[model samples]
Target: MKILIIEDEEGLRESIAEYFTEAGNICETAASYSMALTKVELYRYDCILLDITLPGGGDGISILKKLKENNYTDGVLIISAKNSLDDRLQGLDLGADDYLVKPFHLSELKARVSAIIRRKMYNGSNLLLFNELSIDLQAKTVKVHDTSVKFTRKEFDLLIYFIANKGKVVSKNAIAEHLWGDGIDIADNFDFIYSHIKNIRKKLVEAGGNDYIEAAYGMGYKFTGK
Candidate 1:
């Protein structure tokens, strides 16, 4: 999952980002309201960890309003030191899916974020089914028909990307960005992505799964549920 953490505290922001990154999430941080606004305008996130108190002149609720105005209907989780009932109610009124008070456990935050994403995007279901294949997002397990299929980390990430953007032309760059973030240089990532895709395809086929990935020459791959 892609997440944006908007927090002014350097240590807290980094800690949250690192924890989520280790949990197979693409995380980005913004230390100020302006920076967070720019990121929200530029990229789409599965969930946003927004801090109600911002260093800049603007408030986090303003950002949420702008996102709603711009049709960004993704899950938004508010994180702040403001724990009053009024604050929580106001945040929810501004469209926050959940509220996490400061000094909370990272594990709890992760669980809440996952729940919000599942509710918003997956209809409160953890299992993502495509054809005869099923992926348990919470369990990080994949099954072909009724049997379990083992997969490497890369293979699982690739599959999740394909499933998330099902029936869409997923460019090599998109896959790379989703999997590796800004670490790998784009020119050097095509071969690696192809190899991962090849391995995932081979493993699924060997597991008695139908092929749903189609390659588009000079373009990208598409998951058509074929």
Candidate 2:
């Protein structure tokens, strides 16, 4: 899963990022409200870890308002030191899916993040089916007709993202953000996306799965699942 950690505490932010990255997921961080806002407006993430208090761009409440104003549908999990009832209510009212009080266990944090992602992406289903293709959300593995098919990290991520929005034309920009998070310079027309998709297609086809990904002329690519 792709995650963006919006926290001002540098140490905590790095810890969260490192923890998630080590778990084989793309993770990014923003130290202030401005950076977080810029990231929200420019890219997409499977889950966003928001902190209520920020140095710039007002506070996390305002950031939540901005996200709603933009109609961003991504999952949001607020992580704040403030444990006040009103603060939690306000954050929830503003569209945060989950709230985690600071000084909490990283294991719990991981579990909450995983819950949000599962709810958002798979509707709590670990198995994702697209014809003969199958994806195990919890295990991060793929199978074709019940036969396991190996995939690189990025390749697996891209395949799931494509299948989730199957039949929709997803632009290159969206693909880059979902797979690489804020790590890649997306404005530079990174060509590695094609290579990744190419490899995924080749692997699936070799494993007795159909090529569900279709190029949408000059616009983007579509997962025309059979």
How do the predictions measure up, each by TM-score?
0.88, 0.94
Score residue 12 of candidate 1 by CA lDDT: 94
Local distance difference test, each candidate? 0.87, 0.88
| Collision pairs in model 2 | none
RMSD to truth, every model: 2.3, 1.6
- Scored by TM-score, the top model is 2
lDDT of 2 by residue, 76-102 (tens): 999999999999999999999999999
The regions of model 1 sitting more than 4 angstroms off are 184-189
